[model samples]
Target: MISDEELMALMRYVDGECTDEEATAIRAQLAHDPAYRRAYNEVRQADEALAALPLLEPSTGFNFRVLNQLKAEPHKAVSPISLRKRLLHISGIAIFLLVLPSVLLLLSSGQNPVLILDGSWLPAVGDRQAQVALGPYLQPLLFVNGLLTLLLFDRGVLQPWFRQRHQPPA
Candidate 1:
């Protein structure tokens, strides 16, 4: 099948000059050929119809109304973190943590493990260690953060020093 460009070229041939080779071929095809004539007529009709359609022109007021509508619209705020993304982040952190010690060990494979301590906390840590060895009281330090938080509520919010401060003291 001939391309659209070839058909358009045939239309130009109808106007006037084309290469002798193209002209001769087109002449042979168009002569005594009703089908080729009909096809050329159809192409001319389609081309004319396409050229005759009205072109669009935007109204003078279209720009200002659109911009005003945009300004009147409330801006939407979207959360940066989703539950699935948060879970994926936590999983990535876990994977990093699980591999981190092994990676560090591999990097420092030639070095020996050494004790790490702060000089100021040595006495306090020793006192706690001695308490843990002796009594159940020292178990709180292992999980004192949560316990202390709840204990503060008990000591401050729930506990009553006078039992009736709202009423005049007897």
Candidate 2:
């Protein structure tokens, strides 16, 4: 016939988990009920007995226990290198595409227009032309690829590495 609040208060008294206000309420109730007071006394005695029990340091194998649990767990493998390699390979290909043409035209052919279609630059580059042609594209592409690199590896590589490094060095 006890209310939830009353039962919880009684349980807290039993478990030695009651705050001062909770204990006061429970005490007030016990003053009105002799049977409840007896029960409360018994629980209080049991809680105090438990508190008086001896304490000991944790076992040496606790670290190993945690390590074993981690080892037992199955985790999904995520790799950013593949994506970065793809982007870098693409970027390298783009570089080879642009620069290779200009270099070959300047060196082997010596201003030949016939090999113009095959990776050869007909229009010579100037300072303004460099910025106008490739700067905008390359800068943004590199930044985006770098951001993608950060996103791909942050959860897998960065978080774990930082956690490992800062974990009290045990």
Candidate 3:
């Protein structure tokens, strides 16, 4: 049986890939060894068959269509860092808006409005003192603003991005 190295050398000889010295050695082997001759003929036949295969031409405007498709896509998915940055931006805006009123109030009145349960400033429900304070509103405002920001990001950014990524090409 012929060794793997002999077979490889035969293939390289058939493909015209061997150096002058290697080609001389393989030619000597092919003349003397029937196995080398057979392997060389097989490799030569396969190479001819592969070369004879018709080259397929793509449809017209293939490059244009591919480029247009790539340009149309905005993003495959939102990265975690970008999402974090977006959330931070929304929160910063909300926090600024929330704090602005209080800052303005403090500046206008020059009085720190503490969490007071005085019913006099609030709408009277009964004899009980209603809770009238910025401290109470702060938590609820933060919660609502954060929730709205997240919802908006999901709807406007994430949902569309995921849909585009998953949708089959036309």
| Candidate 1 lDDT for residue 18 | 76
Angstrom error of the Cα, residue 135, model 2: value is 15
Tens digits of lDDT, candidate 1, 1-170 = 55677687677776555788888877787786776777777767877887799998778699777866774545545456544554554464555456556545644555443334444568655634221221232234324534544554444444433443564532
Q: Which residue ranges in model 3 land beyond 4 Å of their true spot? A: 69-170
* Location of the lowest summed lDDT over 10 successive residues in candidate 1: 129-138
RMSD of each: 19.4, 12.3, 13.3
Best to worst by lDDT, what's the order?
3, 2, 1
Score every model by TM-score.
0.26, 0.33, 0.37
Clashing pairs in 1: none
Cα lDDT of model 3 by residue, 29-58, tens digit: 889988778888888999899999999987
Worst 10 residues of 3 by lDDT: 124-133
* Per-prediction backbone clash count: 0, 1, 0
lDDT of 2 by residue, 1-170 (tens): 55666666787777778898888888788999987877777667877888899997678699778777774444546578855755665565555556545544444543322321322343444222221233334445555655655554565466667976886522
Residue 53 displacement (Å), model 2: 3.2
Model 2 misplaced regions, further than 4 Å: 1-5, 14-16, 56-170
